[model samples]
Target: MMSEKILEVKDLVVDLDLDLGDGRTRPVLSNVSLSVSDSEVLGIIGESGSGKTVLSRALVNWVSHPLRVSNGSILYRGQDLLTLPPARMQALRGRKIAYIGSDPGSALDPTLPIGRQIVEKLRSVEPGISTRDAAARVVQVLDAVRIPSARERFYEFPFQFSGGMMQRVMIVDALVTNPDLLVADNITQPLDVTVAAQILRLLQDLQRDFKTAILFVSSSLGVINEIAHNVLVLANGRVVENQSVGQLLSTPQHNYTKHLIADIPRIWKGGPDTAAPAPAAAAPEMEPILSVRDVDRFYATKDREKLFGKQIVQAVRGVSFDVYKGDNLGIVGESGCGKSTLSRLLSCLEAPDSGQILFKGQDIANMKAKELLTLRRGFQLLLQDPYNSIPPHLTIGRTIAEPLLIHGVPRREVHDRVTATMHEVGLSVELYDKLPVGLSAGQRQRVSIARALVLDPELLILDETLSALDQVEQSKLLALFDRLQAQRGITYIYISHDLGMVRRACNRVAVMYLGRVVELANNERTFFDPGHPYTRALLSAVPAIEDRPYKAETYLLEGEPPNPINIPPGCSFRTRCPFAFDRCATDDPRLRVRGLDDLAACHLQEINVPAE
Candidate 1:
């Protein structure tokens, strides 16, 4: 890290005008000042609506929507970007300064090939560069970001790529122009843990190799701690504290910062799985409400050159698990780990290719249309993107009542049930008439929960439902989940990439990798006494305050995951496992009981691992 400043913000203030019934202007940002030096990373930490995004946009002169930079000086390389000429600013955007957004799926053009998109972005900034040179540059950056089959994937559309691959494309696009300063705007928000950590490491490497100053903006303090040398805390658009990462983390001077740190879902487990808490007193004796028996789901991928795409994507391999009446069974893993696919099987939304998913002792795959509908009523699903899930034009009451009305519940009792469910989920009756746009994020999420609970389902499947929420809202919703479980006796299946969330809400967890559950144990054994290397790696990726001074060397998983369509012959994780040997290369290990409360599918129990 160098002392020479690369970018600076002086008294930056941003404002947005709302036209919802009443017109009002609010400060999206206020008197925010900070600087990033060459080869240094500055982390901006705050919650949603805290102006972190707005401030980041203003830095790059990207104020749109109802938002505008009211007052501030955005100095980049000793010049005010706020007042710079449009042509000059455009020239500076990709060549001298770059921006990578959070949602890569939306960021890239779905219609164009990835390589062509990169070439266009490059040529737009450097019109004088030759086409051949631009294409060459594209390949270089793609390889830099570790995109497998870079040359071949260059011609594929955005939809062909996964979330992690698209994120890598975002990074490659941003850095292909060789910008002097990079503004990473929540780039990792859409990624799973392992991919996010990998991207962070990539950014650190890019900084070292290119000497590019990075302004990292995110809502996660742990993400900030991972790569940032300096930390800037923001609350309600005001600068709360700006200090070194060490000082900010160790001796947080501001109360808000302390609260932010405290809210991070801590991993709390070390006891046995048999140690049932008071809320789940009957869990040990209860029969499973749902059982998955060697279920398999496959998808076909498009073949670029072949006339018929014959490639098979084994999305969910033969997997089995059981969900008790009152247990919160958490499913955790990186992207493409088949958690979502399993949720669909559990919810009766889709049928598996083989094997059986028994809900209330009835096989889902054999269920008739009417039986499926009945099953859906008793098994509800809560999705991650509630904004999209809740129809925008529909009123809250109507949205909640749609399910009940479809189930042939008498019209007279529908509104009454909706009202009761709204109250049950902690929503005010007044918001019933309002559209989804009128409610806050937390409220919208509550409305989502209310819609699911309105059915009074015995089994609730929350698939990354709380992942979009901030720490405080997540905590509140978690508490609501607990109360709902305690009061209504609804079983929960929380599928999340957040282990901390799993630790907090789940009694038992299944850690999946490459479409297989490598470890199955209660929260305590899963977090504290993990028998699988992948489980350990996932746990260590979390930034623990107790284990401060984050280092990149810790929790490093080398090489990219193998393609699901062409899985490795033996141990699927052997390519990245540090303890892999001759046995890992030839034989596969099945999930075996390791202790009284856990199962591990690794050769670690068969061999000794020498600590470095």
Candidate 2:
């Protein structure tokens, strides 16, 4: 039974200029053909620079900068989207085919109140609708996302909302008009696993209920396995493989797809810490390298809003964790859940509002002068966006060498260390002189890691560092981190929303929400038998690549995570928890041992022992 066709693209050829010393035109997407149906989710998986983004953008007349679609026929419902006039295309952008941009804030106007922005979307589609009526409609759409106080929040500015809330608002704005198709381009990368899963569930429900088609784009195969009915793999501006999700997962024809599937971590007979037999047992027991104790971080103003007064935004509520030598402590949470706040505190990039962060039993919050400079060598941070992390003006060599030079490493050894570190990150020496603009996203990320590693820090703080890298690059990098850990005992504080990576890469995992650690457990136990409601939600959200089908569980956590500022008393997760009771709202659960050195802060179960 063939599904009703919603969109079709045939022999799409997009041309762009290529500089061959002189100037010449080059075809970016050649003979690209694909289609989508009303009842199907299409997955576009690709490495960076594979023209996946370009091809997707071209669907909505959004060709990236300097890249124009010289030739392509994008048909929507038998109507040509490519040949449509500018005004017609603009009208079709939101009313018929919606786009949920990668950056939620940028997708929405920062200056406009979220409610007004959503209302404006309604008014745009139905110009005859009055402002009051549109406002009511806006509330209804926001309510669809289960955001609390929708009516009151209409006037709230985008900056006032957290990252997850902002994403929800963007989704509401996109869906308010009830578009036929939605294009989500890596929307969940900035969100934590729990919230990321909730968002995916919402999308799934919306797709099932509203019959909306989706072009879900992501670099993670695990995520694609969850939502996509069919998958399309792209690399270097070309399609590598396009098939049903079942075909792609069960028997991937491409080696790239196989690498992608293998990259996602799975539980073996033993746990994550169980070293390979080939590596022998020479590895020593790692000791505590960096410890964070009861760290609380917040951002706000001191003024009482002058006359009306200002309120302080609590980014990180009181939280505590540790990183041991050769250990990777994966902090998983949605964006704006204070994961980065904790990272900044550990790196001494930002100080906590309260509590002591002891590095080697010495408080780093109060480090001064030369001591601070010396302490920096012991810890370094690798950020998510490589473009922002590295100076575009500097060559790769200089970018990596700058850290060593700043620390007064000898000029002779600087080059050696930089080259060795670059190779460690899978970057070739030929790229040593290339600027960030000249490198691919994956290569640029490698440069970022190389720069961080050249300093020889005892601890590495990876803040979604591998988020932008493709499957192959990610696997190579993970292998590199593993080798570095085994050889040098370098500890890591890995902060990411991707659970698959966390499961494969980290020794232990910590789940965070609204500025607190909700759960902490080993990788195997965390996935197979989650102790906390939030942890279970996160695990259930992760899509497996194996043959098993996905079951939609009703363990729904409603409402956007509570505002960090003025967070409700007792359990922070209670407002959205499906199992929460009156007792949960009054008494906060302390972190306590449950099973096999695992700890979770939830009142539902005092001691949860995993089934054999």
Candidate 3:
């Protein structure tokens, strides 16, 4: 332990009013307490609505409006945060303690360049510093996060960088002043597994290198297991359990903690063969709702005449798959792996370059405008961020009803449908009039779901819909999905980065890498006995809540995935796959049935195969 305690939060209580239409108050977060010491990494893990994010936000006196500290003490180095004068607290913030939130793009100023943002922070903390000196310091700090061309990148705006790069910039900005304590809330959710792992490793190295304490917050327990020293399990805004990572992993005293670990998507007892016996061989079988055959999609670059610039990005290359009525198909991969593109192709949002997309045995590629509108009503997409998908200004009722209106539903019918959908999604009719901005993240997500369900779509495309949610909220939505599936036979194309969630939510899984399907299998088999090397690496990359005695040596991919346009000739994953052989580079392996209810595309067959 260091001589100075970085932060000590004691008996912190935050309360929010649900504004129950007429007048009602509901307790959000009850009494909570935790502490972080110098050089220590403290984790707060729980499901959505568990109050972990709230508690962290309150620590910085930046709690969202309508939520306030009803009672509690946030003591940082002997100073009470809740009682500090506004000016004094503002001055102390970022200098002594800083917060790195979930979305760096949202945190960063959009119009200014990254360099200017860094310079502003440096100047704010050190008013007397010269511009030349500040620019030099900014370059030094940017290099610390491994951002290439540190001096040049400072002049680039947030939008100019990729999602991963923006995160690195935000991290550099947070540490610019060398704050003693930092609160990182789901900071890496937007990043791919490889990049996420790199970020965590960097943070771990920084903690040792700089001796800065961190309050690491996330919904995923596997993420918590990687870098955290101590763990605090929060449920409904109260601390349910707290311990060192080793102790928590080995012996979780709380039932919730145990359940969270157990709920992690893993190979079931029977493994790949555990897909409910394939529906009794389908005696009274219905026709497949969606069938994609020989799908090949390519996008042309803007500069076609320049050398290596006229390339076409192959998004879905010779992919063939089918979705049976009422079956859930999960697509899992790193960001930009073409899950969204494939979803749009299935929904007829884009035509394949040289393939057939059949919806109900009919080609939708050339559907008439009216027919297209009708087709859209049969399949709906649920976006990841409800904020962007759900309009904030409109009341919940109007948002739900707007879809029905566009479909030319009668006014009376639209009202009835919207109200019914709201009730079905666990929202009261009274909440129908509340704007989305007034609702919690969970409630807003629920509203978005209601809006989608209001159209009564048979097939729903969940494009990482639950990624933004915490665990508790995610669990609720998962249960809701199960209910909707069972009751309405609503099929789903569930796309997600969180493999555990995919395992829990999907019956069948499809693994994608560099815009190609590398494997498809029953969920159990995919998790336990993945046949494809890429699938194995992806599954291995998933953080586990329970730490296994043996940690496999990680095969971090050598470089950024080859440019999507000029992808290598064979096996799209060959560039990053350790199992890639001479044949793998020249011959693309087609999806092959390797086991009962399992398909893999790689030439190699092994678990945790070493990368050369």
Candidate 4:
């Protein structure tokens, strides 16, 4: 039986009006057409700047000024949405058709409690809805999304939730109205693998129960394969192909589609595409460039229940790791796993409450301000958001040269060094004096890299650096990093949830869970034969084009990690571990040697037990 078409877009053409004196327009999306059937998911895949976002917006007639739809007919249940009255279209948006954007942090009202915001949305959509009933429904959906303590968190503001939880709240916002068509625009792009998997599963369940058709847009083929029933390929604003997920994967007919599929990084599969094995362990005589021992970082947050008291949040606890020179170490974990906190500590942006952080045999954690400032020149930190990292007002050359100027480099030397670094990172010298206003995401990131490299830092800590880029841009950046590493012999610490990219770049892997390193091993050992169950769960949850050794059904986690403040006793991961035993509840496991240069914190290691 053919399913009923819920939404159809015909010959959609969208153009961006350039601000030049001449009325010239650039085609953002041209001749794009697709449809979503009842309870079906239509996946749209493309690289960044491929007009996928514009197309998603146009599906619901939400394309605003500057981006005008030149020609299109958007039909929602045979009613032309494009020609609908503004009042009627506005009414249909939240009540029948909903949209969820990628950045959840900016979606919600900061001042209002998330629950109240959703309740207000519900009441606005359906004026007859009672406040009590709307609140009840909002809490119900929040619970359904596996947000812990849905009722209590109802009064919590948006700032209180993690990225994953905020995303769940946004999902609750979109689904609270029981919208017939849901447009999720790159919603899971910024999430962790485990959290993203949870969302995908949640969407599947929601689609089944609510019969809501979804127009899912993302740049990841693996993510599309997870939930999309049919795939639509878009390139520079045109639909190249549309096919079922299985057929698209096996027999993609378009060159652009094939290139996109080929760009996806493989984890378990070994081929020419996979990254080469990391350099062998540093020589025995060589000391690690960075060593973290028994590090613990804690933040004091105002106690919501008490007026004067504060709660200590253990952000990083008993974390220890060694980074040898020239090693590309990958730290993989879910959100709120203390990866960011550890990065801050490593970069000396924050000091650990306890333990030692030794850089080049010097205890950086205890270094004085002046000494620390000098030591900081040896290492630099690259953050996730390229758009915000560089100062917008400064020109590219000035941005890169600022670091050199700070260190008292000669003015002439600064200009030459910045120019050389800019060239090295593949930025055209023409952009040297240009502001970062119109640079692509990849270009902005290159500027950030050049700035970080101008100091000739030996150790570079990248915190979700490439997560914002599309696969193609990410691939380009990874290759650029590889080239820079070969020439500079720079050591990199990749703090990311992207296991595929980690597998492609890093030689050593560290699996962190709730502020602790549960598993640490070489890339081969970590990917092929993980020692910890949490590691196994993370591996299982990764979306991949190639077959994964770990299956989600067997190893996928059920919920988010326990709150760091109210961490359970014994093994912290026991609550979500499918194979957890009575011993796991009473005895806390510490990192124990599993093999040569491999360590895992799991009770099963002691009993010689294997994962079921």
Q: Number of the top candidate by TM-score?
A: 4
lDDT of 4 by residue, 93-162 (tens): 9899999999999888899999999999899889998999999999999998888889999999999898
Instruction: Report the error of model 1 at residue 134, Å.
Output: 1.8
RMSD of every prediction: 2.7, 3.5, 4.1, 1.4
- Residue ranges of candidate 2 with Cα displaced over 4 Å: 1-3, 19-23, 121-126, 267-287, 302-314, 546-554, 604-612
Candidate 1, residue 292: lDDT: 90
Spell out the clash pairs found in candidate 2: 50-236, 50-237, 191-334, 192-333, 192-334, 304-309, 304-310, 305-309, 305-310
lDDT for model 4 comes to: 0.92
Model 2 weakest 10-residue run by lDDT? 274-283
Q: Could you give candidate 3's per-residue lDDT for residues 1-612 as a string of tens digits?
A: 335677887777777767677646566778787778888999999886788778778888887657877777888988998888888888788587888988887888899998887888888878899888988988998888888778888888887686777878888888888889999999887777766877887898788888899999988887898989899998777889999988987889999989887655543434455333222221346577888888888898666357665657777777777888767788988766888888788777788888788888888876788888988888888888867888878888999898899989989788788998999999989987787775777888889899899888988988889888766578788889889887998988888887767767777888888777888887667766667767666655667654322223545543356668778887778877765678878988777777765777777743334232
Clashing pairs in 4: none
Please report the TM-score between candidate 4 and the true structure.
Answer: 0.98
Question: Worst ten-residue run, lDDT, model 3?
Answer: 274-283
Better of 3 and 4 by lDDT: 4
- List candidate 1 segments past 4 Å from native: 20-24, 268-285, 548-555, 606-612
Clashes of each: 0, 9, 7, 0
After aligning candidate 3 to the native by TM-score, how far in Å is the CA of 515 from where it should be? 1.5
lDDT of each model, Cα atoms only? Answer: 0.84, 0.77, 0.79, 0.92
